[model samples]
Target: MPKWTAADVPNQDGRTAVITGANTGIGFEAAKVLAARGATVVLGVRDTAKGSAAAAQIVAASPGADVRVQRLDLTSLDSIRAAADAIRADFASIDLLINNAGVMYTPKQTTADGFELQFGTNHLGHFALTGLLLDMLLPVPDSRVVTISSVGHRMQAAIHFDDLNWEKSYSRVGAYGQSKLANLMFTYELQRRLSGKGKTIAVAAHPGGSRTDLMRNSPLAFRLAYKVIGRLITQAPSEGALPTLRAATDPNVLGGQYYGPSGLGESRGAPVLVKSSAQSHDVAIQRRLWTASEELTGVKFPV
Candidate 1:
């Protein structure tokens, strides 16, 4: 039996994929492999300069690879709308939408819309992006939406409805957990809604433990020092990207399914089907979160 490395990624000819935060780390790795396999990959990042460099790197590796960059600042609704409008105006149908960009532990911060930064960027940003672009995908056969979550979801996570913004108090770790948990719930609920349409499906994936720039802000009740534990337990960014790539391209993946590494506790190994936290599977909470998200972002799904 052969192991599933980036070499195993199926040919993605003629597919158009939009990947947020693709300038580096897992997102960049995913874009590189997909582009090499013949997909027209879009690197969605907050910095166009970095995005262009990432694009240049991809094209350099796979000479003539169709890859480009688009500015996407998840913390600002204005930026998200601008990005979506740009994408919608050009592409009538989308093959894949990967919500791979996220912010981890950081000092309490607010988005341009005044929401908690982690939740705003990690969940609402992707939620609104998916809704705005869903019409482009729904009419296209077999299009998929993949949201990246995290093992950090299990760390005292919940919606914190009364203070979704953490207005009264702030705990960066708690906010991060809530955001990641919302990622899974959003995927589950979105899958249910999309099931009736049949043209698209929603799936979730987590990097497990990966050495990526996204973790620079880590500080919490980590089992060990954040950087030390990550260095000891994490896999490379390319390996970290497998779950997301598999969730996006695997022909057998079903709506609402999750993908993660196969190593102990799903920290690092070959990508495979994995179970999410039990809370992620709860229907009632998922519905409530969906409504709250729609209200906050003001983007309604066509589904």
Candidate 2:
């Protein structure tokens, strides 16, 4: 089948979407397109000012776009809970939840909940937020959850069962790779659990190398390298968002089906169904990760 583009996404007249990190980069682009297509978009972001600005920009670009801003700091459990509560109080249902917020290579730092930064924000935070919003998601027929992983996931050596939090040792790139891998594992496991419960919400998608502010938080050396060499390798943020939009809105998409770019090395192009590494499908590891996540976040899936 041919790769899909944003234009291929069906009309989303009455649907509602919540996009994490919608203040900038690929998430911002995705939110803009969804709102333009008539979906009510809730921008879940860390910075209230930036989120409002992004919403304003989208509304300006697409007049009549139903875009609103909500503060969400994924690294903080208290913030996550508060954001989820606010959404619950305002919306009856959420048709799409895009786990698009993430952290890249950075010096070792812990979240407010003491989790290693990348894994905490990138995986565990979303895991908790999704679980908290399960009631809202379950009522909407054909609702979907799109977890954004990365091509860098392939670099993950293993689950690091003994050191999931990197307490023993930490390498910024390795930790980031592991977190992305965790995203894929979480996506698949979520599909599995939802399927067993007869839920129809599909879960999938991964952006290939995209030039975005995700690099801005990186170490100085990494940021410089990305600034110089990234231009030649990474696609624009708008292009990077296509796979996510396709995953969220494509009627043909099925649960657990991953998508990414079709260009050489899965770096740039329209969104196409892509294969994940064998390690990504390890059920035992996924189960362990899920358990660990629940313990870490103090949030459990109702399944």
Estimate every model's Cα lDDT from 0 to 1: 0.91, 0.89
Tens-place lDDT per residue, model 2, 1-303, is 655777887889999999999999999999999999999999999999999999999999999899988999999999999999999898998999999999888789999988899989999999999999986887677889999999878875467878888999998888998999999999989888888574456576777889887776676887788778887778999999999998898887899999899888898888988998999999999999999889989998876
- Inter-residue clash pairs, candidate 1: none
Q: Where does model 2 exceed 4 Å of error?
A: 1-3, 196-198, 217-228
lDDT of 2: 0.89
> Across residues 155-226, which tens digit of lDDT does each residue of candidate 1 receive?
889889999999999988899999999999999999999988869999999998888877677665553576
Clashes of each: 0, 0
lDDT of 1: 0.91
**How many clashing residue pairs, candidate 1?**
0
Quick one: how many clashes does candidate 2 have? 0
Q: Which ten residues in a row have the lowest lDDT in candidate 1?
A: 219-228
